[model samples]
Target: MSGRLSATVVQQCVVSLGDVRTRIDVSIKRRFLADQDRVYPGLECPVPNDDTVELLSSVIDLYGLTREVLLLEIPSYPRLEGATVPDSGGSNSGQDQDQTDGHPFAVLSEFRERMAK
Candidate 1:
């Protein structure tokens, strides 16, 4: 059996720790064979071909499948446009600081150089 699935969820931003709204829409098509080692005739799986999860038995969990889809669709790091992640120094420039030029991880670089020395 095959069908479509859609979900709406809110995820926390990686940097800002704010709510990030996300939508998941996917086409699910699964072919269950009778205790077969491999699928045949140009087989198509519910998930992507590269990432396929074989379903056990004749039953499929719709709720679990929906949750899985939503988890995959959500971004690992969701940042708003024009929003900037504060540097490690914890200095709040309030958007006035020109962060485009200076070395963001200068301390790490310095530590690496010192180790080499």
Candidate 2:
């Protein structure tokens, strides 16, 4: 079986924690083979390099296949174009101030500075 999948999803940007809209379009093809071992008595069947083949089962779950395909196509770390991740060591330049404000670890640095005094 073969089909095309297209979807749009909103993901959080790894850098800015902002909404990142992503579009995915992919072609899926799957071939199911039943009783391949029985067909060849002694010789081992060569495994295909690509993920297009599967062992035939009593039921073919199209919904599960579609969900998996969609997940594989989605970006693991979605980022907006031109957005930069703030440096971990902290920046002397005020340019990154706004960016760092929303960072989860921003408060830790502030607390450290206070304790140093």
RMSD of each: 7.2, 6.4
Candidate 1 local lDDT, 6-69, one digit each (tens): 7777877777777777777888765544443355545553343544445467677777776776
The clash numbers for all candidates, in the given order, read 0, 0
lDDT of 1 at 112: 91
Error of 2 at 23 (Å): 0.7
- Give the number of colliding residue pairs in candidate 2: 0
Return the top candidate by lDDT: 2
> Runs in model 1 with CA error above 4 Å?
37-58, 90-117
- Looking at model 1, report the run of 10 residues with the lowest lDDT sum: 91-100
Error of 2 at 88 (Å): 5.6
TM-score, one value per model: 0.54, 0.68
lDDT of each: 0.64, 0.86
RMSD of 2: 6.4
On a 0 to 100 scale, what is the lDDT of residue 28 in model 2? 94
